[model samples]
Target: MKISSKYLCVILLCIGNTSVFGQSTFGRLKQKATGIAEKVIDKKTDELLEDKSGKKDNTRENPTEKVKKERVKKQNTVYDFQSGSTVLLKEDFLPDVTGQFPMQWYTRSKGEVVEFNDVPGKWLQLYSGTFLSPTVLLKENYTIEFDVIIDFPPNGNYPLPALKIGLYDRGNKGYILSNDYRVKNNVNIILSPYRNELRVKLKSIENNSNKIATENYILPDFTAKLGKPVHIAMDIQKERIRVWIDQEKIFDLPQTVPVSNLLNQLRLELESSNYKNSELGYYISNLCFADGSPDTRSKLLTEGKLESNSILFATNSAKIESDNQGVIKEVAAALKQDNAIRIKVIGHTDSDGTPKQNMALSQKRAESVKRELIEKYGIGENRIETLGKGDTEPVEKNMDPNEKAKNRRVEFVRL
Candidate 1:
């Protein structure tokens, strides 16, 4: 039979429509890939910070506490100091980064003070100190956290930029965080010990009775870079200690001596080598010892730790992150007052599944959560969207069966 021209053109149009539909279907099929990454964190973030504590070992008990239980030293004790738990810091502290302060006997070179040697975005050296102190501060059982910057100069004393922490008593002779002058046959090793200088010498002072010296050891593995900043923390409690550098745990040891006096000095010493004249400086600002200071362990655990995303993932079951309905409600109220916010609901799964399966599962899960949030919880759908990342990105690696189980999860984002 002979077909008319008009009828033939209509048939061609239908053919084109069918081809486009087929392409769309195929594109979606490809996206439903199997075993692709989805979680960018690549580790478990659902785990919360856990505080572990135990009684101090009898080996580290104060001699006075053991031998002379009734007699308590009143002067050097921080137990009665006003600087504990809720102490308020001075306002206008470290007023400027390019200034200095000298008290009757002590001096403070902090905030942002520049040397002729400064690179943009590179930190200026900030420091505060007292020449000498009558007693100690954070002793036996305490936690200290603070931010730090490691700086180096092309010409001066300290040639390397490292985060140096030292503890000594009375005399300035001790191991300053593993200053190995013998490394690489570098002759400047003699000065390496001084690079992490300590004013106190534990061996020199006689402990009331225990053979333990006043010198406290922190971490031997703290490293810093020039022109860079690191938020560092060192905690000593219950014959155990932990170190956090830039919100990362570089060193963790359970048994280190404590700083007995609040007068104890915390310094970020620069690295020194035999390599010629180099000005070494470290930016150490916002020094705090209070239990919940702004820059203390608590701060690091919540804000600093999560943002840095440097903490090692714990190999355990996938823990549900607590979402407070009260807070979410409050957010809705805020939105009513100031319009609304855009939020995204994302779904994820482990790497053990095919991409297509994982993607479909993720999409369904995201939609389920979105429906609940909008209908039951009062979050707006227009202000909210859903995404299924499949197994492409994981907060923690599923290198093993245990980790794979932990990677299956969901997340919420408000923008």
Candidate 2:
């Protein structure tokens, strides 16, 4: 006796669901489905699968000791940047198209999103000369955190890339900062790799006059770790600014710059004039900006819900990204403050993949969040429960890619 095609389809569905909902013993079924589905899917689908698997499709050049030292030191040091309790804007470049400029961002010169073997997510690669900024809500007191990888020449004798990371208050209409004639309150962080120095400059317009302050520091020796990624975190309060490079505190100067005025935009100006080719360039990823300090306890317990897209996870995989752990650590700290509180962690995903795949992925991600809170944050496991909503519920429509990204989030709800 043979089963009908309809029954066979139902059997497959059951198998897939069990594979997703069941214990790790049934994981092979999901893997089998992925293998079978890949054969019939288009090239784009295959690329997406590879990304979710946390593997690069192409080869990459080896990084130097500078990047390696940054990673090694990060493990022992707890990155204390709380990322402003309320995240206003977060850009991981996941919603953007590869090899094309991102939608929310504007650049006078050419800069496009591209995959990097060193990192799990997509990165914005700034060309020889480019000015890039995101058209998002910006506030005066905000925190900016991003990962930068400078591609040094194979022979260290060559001059490395020069990058200028600036914050500008460009009043209203114009796109480029040069054209913005209004009182432009600008704070610029300049990184000169060749001279092994970092500089912070303030150009503020007040009472129709300009006040400027400049601070410079000799960068720590990263000669051995060239080509490796560096993590940069900056905090701007009313009249003070704090900066951190890797595990080291670069500076925390009060009144070094005026922040009384509202500064609303971030700019990345990349230039490699001294370098020979585009290969001697730089990459930026995991750019997150958040302003205002909100009480986590009040936001979580009283409000009953807390949501963030800052929890970085590898594409398609349940493993959380390292640099993204700062936000999760913040969440864990808040929960540890109250032992009586019990919470439910819900995982969500966009409608990019099949329902079964998305369900399994979301469940794994939710479990990952719970695991971090318990083991890393030292929270009691009994107090937390996990659920995967998959793509069943979305906060926004999926027609727009940005909306899809908004839907793919993790929420902590009070139980």
Candidate 3:
């Protein structure tokens, strides 16, 4: 009464499609199915199963793993983008239920919070011709950071729709999703990824309904970044606007945005294209809008203390994210300007885990910051002291994700 591996695979597939199988039985069958699959299935099918099961073959190196490691190494080494300190808006789509529109966002077209197969956390998937806007008024000088994933089938040949992000003045109107989504005063940054290259275009409009500045740049090798998470940062300082995709600064103009423009709305649009919704996927998450460029020198040297929300870390870990190293570099520069200055680095966390775990994590985060300053910036180890406050000293109540983000910050105290 022995069954062939082929029949076993078919049985497993049938069980996976139906809910008649219990959890424990399904788990056992899956293990057996994969175990038998390794011997009978082709290499490509085995690889797909491994990815689905979140397992890896140790005998051979995975090209995806190698690329990820290389990308992380490159990110850690190149640190020029500086995120803003004050939290104006932080949207992770954590509270939104899957298959529903986000509660705190306005969209002219349809979108939903969806969880991906390979990526963690929830993302807001935007359809073509969608205009999504967060329900927050932006400040004059602020920075916007978000992670976007444009997924397309590996074998499908399709045109990629451009993603447009801009700050517009909605004439003090309150959270209106207009039919004609255009404003007189706005600064738009468009990212168009084609077959082999990426075209970045920046255009700013003034109150007079005139296109004041327009710039376009092209970057080769965009195929390397497709179907992966790409970090995008936009910094607007009065009349100047700068944008960075990952580590590369694509746009830096001295006078791209008008100083007199009253920009209060942050809009994200997926331009209309011929591709169907199923063919091309557009997902975005971890959106943060922070106001004002951090004055590290003035805050640390003059005020004697600086609380920075820009130095970000991995979730539940002390590993510092690469793009946030600019704030640390700025602090290091301040220390170098005054050799006699010795400062204390204090780490804080939101109320996510237990008190003891939070305490340990905060301490480790403080040590990580100290290590980065000493190792990367050549700051003396003895000059920097470290401390952790855990969730006890939160600047904001841990009510929502935005408040939690404000609580999770690093402080530099001039000692």
Candidate 4:
């Protein structure tokens, strides 16, 4: 048979294409396999090196928790202040405008939300003799935890910073505006960070049953940790009270506080000192209040509702704060346990804006909660519903401007 040049060329082209395609496919497969094998070898090398070095892998863990665990191990003992089960009033001061007084708190003397070069977020800078109080009804059994930075030099010869944290009541005298240090019926916890000295007085209204307690401790690396954020946790149960600074329990006393004082407010007073210049400062953040007696299972499953103030949101936005993720994780776990159960998340806002605007804000916040549950918590989207009240269904009457804060919260209702 006589073959044309065209047919011969086509036959050659087919053969050439098949050979090229086969080589290309093999090359890709070989490259992929090599890449995977290298990954496996690198992982094995890492494991071997880790075993030889006896170093644990904590790269993926929270940095704050990693530091805490390391510090705990060094102590050779466990010091735990289990937080209150149900959060009541939590103020991260995220919504507060920097360089101004916080909206959620009342201050007689001037204090503003200020930033520190060493700290990560905003803090309330309390000036001397200023008493900052939050508007919330105090329960007899509750826990208060906050972070504070005392700007006094740790080893300076100058006078140290004196900060007083106290609980007081507003009687018929109309919010007794006086020296908090001398206030009767006030339970004061005085902190002197530089000297490592603390004095707590559970003052009685009658002045006869006052109980004073003093504590002196060798602060762990006091000079090294000065001006750094220190966690303060306090628990008050009826007449008994306890306090923890960082990981150490500095105060524990029973029947010291008066059970009948009806202390309805928490106050922070910075005493006047000669070192009250720019270097002399006091700042606080991450204030959390919770029910001293709480049953999480009962609150969620039986009561059919879960309330939290700690689920902080960004200023005028739906973005949840990263520090409050643990609260959402717990709710997600509960929902996952019971596949048949469904929940409706309701968001509320204080009476700060118009009803229409507030309603939209509330709805967006509710949707944000739903998104957090489904995306971060592995919950089914179909099992959740969201609603917003927007200052309509308030738990407390908006009497004082600060009182409006109680109306802003999130609730989970089981359906």
TM-score of each: 0.31, 0.48, 0.52, 0.49
- Scored by CA lDDT, what does every candidate get? 0.41, 0.70, 0.79, 0.72
What stretches of model 2 exceed 4 Å from their correct place? Answer: 1-79, 154-159, 171-183, 195-210, 294-415
The positional error of residue 104 in candidate 3, measured at the CA in angstroms, is 1.4
lDDT of 3 at 184: 67
Q: Least accurate stretch of 10 residues (summed lDDT) in model 1?
A: 182-191
Expressed as tens digits, the lDDT of each residue in 8-27 for candidate 4 is 56445555676655767656
Winning model by lDDT: 3
Question: Over all chains combined, what TM-score does candidate 2 have?
Answer: 0.48
Candidate 2 clashing pairs, residues 3+ apart or interchain: 52-315, 52-316, 64-225, 64-226, 65-224, 65-225, 65-226, 66-225, 66-226
lDDT by residue for model 1 over 10-71, one digit each (tens)? 44555566665576664553343211212212222212222234444456668866756543
The TM-score that candidate 1 achieves is 0.31
lDDT of 2 by residue, 379-414 (tens): 989999999988998898898888987888898898
| lDDT, ranked from best to worst | 3, 4, 2, 1
Structural RMSD, model 3: 20.4
How many steric overlaps does candidate 2 have?
9
The top-ranked prediction according to TM-score is 3
Better of 2 and 3 by TM-score: 3
List candidate 3 stretches off by more than 4 Å.
1-78, 153-158, 171-182, 294-415
